[model samples]
Target: MPLTRRSVMDAAAARFGWRRAYGTTTEVDALLTEQSETAYTASASHAELATAKNHDALAVQPGVLDVRGRILADVLYLEGVLTGARNRGLPSEVIERLEDVVDHGHELTVLLADAVRATAAAHTAGR
Candidate 1:
């Protein structure tokens, strides 16, 4: 969903009170800053990701992008303040992390599905 000012404003009003979920602009900025810093920080390990790279990342790129787009859309839908997290104000580190997610998102999706299937299989076997 394209985020318009009017739509975000309405969503913000609904998610937040006359104020916002954050008590102060400073609080919001601080949290955004922390998230940005974390996102920017280099990960020490990505072994699971290396092991999971079965398919051509290029071939799976579109679907992965779509999935990520939806996740971002969901976030915007649920929490409409891009002033801190979504826009240019966001730290470069945060942006890099988001890109990394997009890059390896298909593997993440497959991992999640496998977990779910494992749980279901376990439940059925017990039954």
Candidate 2:
């Protein structure tokens, strides 16, 4: 389904436990708003934002109208691992891979953040 402002705000509210003003378009606007007003905004690019923040903990597309896609993806990954382990059906290799992923979740976030920042920087530069 196409993403909508309501859906994004609802997801944010559910995940962050923030009481959203339904259909008011506040959360969606905050995330989607352009960063043209901040002083020194050009100096600090999107890459900088990604580098400064924990991207893995944050959504993959933090600037998008929908900010929950990345978090939900991580949740799904965890669920898959849990299901595999619970069934004792996880292959040794798969289990080892999962262990690595779990252990490096933070690192993965950093990596993702860097990539995002780079993409943002390119986008900003092009415009």
| Predicted model with the maximum TM-score | 1
Give per-residue lDDT, candidate 1, residue 99: 54
Taking the tens digit of each residue's C-alpha lDDT, what string does model 2 give over 1-127?
A: 2347656866888898786553446645653553344535665687777667744423445554133347446856875776678589767776777766765664555665666677677666766
How far residue 3's Cα lies from its native spot in candidate 2, in Å, is: 28
Between which residue pairs do clashes occur in model 2?
A: 47-117
The Cα error of candidate 2 at residue 44, in Å, is 21
- All candidates: CA RMSD (Å): 14.3, 14.6
Model 1: clashing residue pairs?
40-93
* Maximum-lDDT candidate: 2
| lDDT of prediction 2 | 0.60
